[model samples]
Target chain A: MEYAYYPGCSLEYSGKPYDKSIREVFKALGVKLRDIKDWNCCGATMYVSIDKIVACSVAARNLALAQNMGCDICAPCNSCYTILRKVNRYLAYDPEMRGKILEVLKAANLTYDTPVDVRHPLDILVNDVGLDTIKEAAPYRFDGLKVAPYYGCQLVRPEHHFDDVDDPMTMDNLLTALGADVVPFASKVRCCGGSLMTTCEEVALDLNNSILKDAEDNGAEIMVTACALCQMNLEGYQKKINKRYSQKHNMPIVFFSQLIGLALGVNPKRLGLQSMLVKPKNLKLIPKGMKVEA
Target chain B: MPSIPPIPEPKRQREADLREAFLKEVAGIPAGEKIKNCIQCGTCTATCPVSRWMDITPRETVALFRAGMLEEILESRTIWICASCYSCTVRCPMGIQVTDLLYALKRLATDKKIYPSRFPAHALSDTFISSLYRFGRIYELELGLRYFLKTHPLKLLANIGFGLLMIIKGRMAILPKRIKKANEVKAIINRAKELEGV
Candidate 1:
């Protein structure tokens, strides 16, 4: 499968592991990812919170760019995927806004009249790439490596287009197919407070505390998520989470793609596993070293 | 002199206007909401993970909007406190897009500029939008620096250690990449603002 990739801002920065792993995994799966040229941020939750028209326009520009690619736009970041998908839906559903979005796009010499298929990598990996094909490429079995699949809030909520909103099992099933022990994970769909970590520290930390505690108590050796922000919020803020809660949480939060990359025999360094804030302690069972074209 | 209760704001017209205004304020509201079908059941409140922190619970946010309590809704921290989790949006039996409604409310509050200066999250949106236009992409380092400087200088100092660790670990991209079409992005944004005429 070929896709127009939108890595968004988080993936280029704090969520670098997601970018690296996603690319490596997709490459190993025989999928081609084309970068959307001069793509802007998807306006995110912040822009929408500020101005609906501006945010919609900002998101629309990328959809416009991807339209020429003649393929679905696949984003690893949940916010990017959600914003792109939501804005596209908004443009299609409301004629008035759609007209305005068209005019706004014209200002940049762009146009988008069709619905954009903004896909999450997990959705693409499972449905588009198919689990059977993914399993066939795997050289390493997880040996029931206790894993927690954290879906965060955006990828499957508001619109359960690809998975169940309340109890999503796509990630759970995908990891299981790789021979990892998927935990019950009560907080799988829970919020990690997202950007709220920067603004409302206590609230975000409290939320992360529950997520970390839930996974740890449930016997998860590591937590894998599809959202860049979720990974960064949970893993990036571990020190603060530990300090605030007075709990020693040395959990290795990883991108779901990295786990797949490991199973596919991609080198840990290529998966950006070495950069994890809390080093991965449970990946010993999986063999590494795939000759990647990076 | 009889103390007239300020005639209560023409109750019905203002309520209609808020709903009608919402149709234009944000996308996702065009299909219309069964907001009138809301039984004040507080289902949205129960589903909201951040309800406890909100000054105006999700249930009241709807009720107040219907009641034309724009002042109360605007002043309350409920709109900003929302994490946009959409748990409430999914659970609302009335099919009210509660999260999108909050986004509309945030747009309204931002336009009126009534939110307190110390409100931390408010700084996030405009700065983020501005950065989106400026570089055609986000510069997280600058965004974080500006956010903390505006909201809490102490947090900025606290984050230095964390920032250093991230850079060392190769997770933090210290530099922001400016897109080649930044001018076009700015032009489009400016044109959008003019067209929006907010």
Candidate 2:
């Protein structure tokens, strides 16, 4: 399978591990990520709230760029995925908005036909790669470790359109197929308190603590999420919470793709597992019979 | 940590009344077309994680919207509890978008200065300020450290530990800098101010 890629600004910088691992894992599974030439930021989280026209124009710039290349686009960041999807759906139905966005794009020498499909990397793997291939590729089954599949805000929220905004179990099913036990948690759609971490540290810490607490309460040793922002928010903040509060809990938050890569026999170091703040302690947690070569 | 004072009742009203301004601010959005069509079906409430801890439901907030009780919806602590799940929009029978409404409400709430969100969401503006003030782009390490410094100073030390670990792993850059067009980014922020008139 092939897709036009919109890495957004974050993926190129601090989120390089996410970009690196996603490419390696997908390539190992025989998928291609064709970078969308001349792409810009999705306005991060501010454009949506601050300005509709600018947000749509910025997101459409990437989509128009991808459509020009004749490929469906994939956004690894949850915010980017939401922005692209929102603009794609918004411009598709609203002619006036579409016209305005197109006019804005024309000034930048780009035209969007809304030809490209805006899909998350998770959707591509679960829907395109299929569970059978994933199961066949798994060198070790994640049998005993209980995991909570976190959908976070961007992917499921605005539940106006997209997959089930709540009780989303697609990732759970895929993970289950890879042989790990999945936990049924109600806070899957909860916010990881993203950029709020900066302006409001106290509140963001509480938000991060709440997510980790819920995961710990649910008996999950690891939390799996799709958005790099969510992963960073949860894992990075967990260390601070643990230290400040003198908390003993340390749940390793991982990208779903990294877990899938592990099951497929990819080395953890190669997948950037060592770089995570909340490192997985005690490999003995994995059931004895379900050991991957990694 | 310094204790934050509670919002005085009269001061709270000034803060609560800002939702009207937010609604007016977003009046031109084509996306806001369904604001009036919201049916209180409780799908958003059913899906909202914050509903468990807060006093009102997401569905009730929609009901307040349909009733033209904009102030009540904005003033509700439930508004602060919103995780921006968008579940309300996804499940709305009338297709009223609820998540963006919450975001706009947050802007209004913050403006009113009555919003008592003492935790994480409050840090967003600070993160943006640090990013804009230094590197044109956000520095996750600084943002992360600054965030932890609020309630958990010890966590800041832990972040340094993690940063050291990341550096040793060759994952993070020792020096954080802006990419090309750093000035253009500030222009975008300036443009937002011009448009919002804040």
* List of chain A TM-scores, every candidate: 0.96, 0.91
Off by over 4 Å in 2: A159-162, A243-246, A282-294, B1-31, B37-47, B50-83, B91-94, B105-198
Cα distance off (Å), candidate 1, residue A146: 0.6
The two-chain DockQ for each candidate, comma-separated, is 0.75, 0.22
Candidate 2 retains true contacts at a fraction of: 0.23
Per-residue lDDT of A1-294 in model 2, one digit per residue for the tens? Answer: 789888876676556667867887888888889987645566666655445665567567667768866667888888888878878777876777677667666655667764688888887888888888877766667776789999887886653344676677778888888777788787787777676555445656777788888888888888998887788778776667877677766788888878877777777887777777778754332432555554
* Per-residue accuracy of model 2 over B7-30 as CA lDDT, tens digit each: 578746653455457667456444
| Model 2 error, position B198 (Å) | 10
DockQ of 2: 0.22
Q: Candidate 1 chain B, which ten residues in sequence have the lowest lDDT sum? A: B23-32
Interface RMSD of 2: 4.4
* Whole-model Cα lDDT of every candidate shown, in order: 0.85, 0.69
Q: For residues A34-136, what per-residue lDDT tens digits would candidate 1 score against the true structure?
A: 9999898888899888788888898889999999899999998889888888887788788888898899889999999667699989999999999999988
TM-score of each: 0.94, 0.76
Best by TM-score: 1
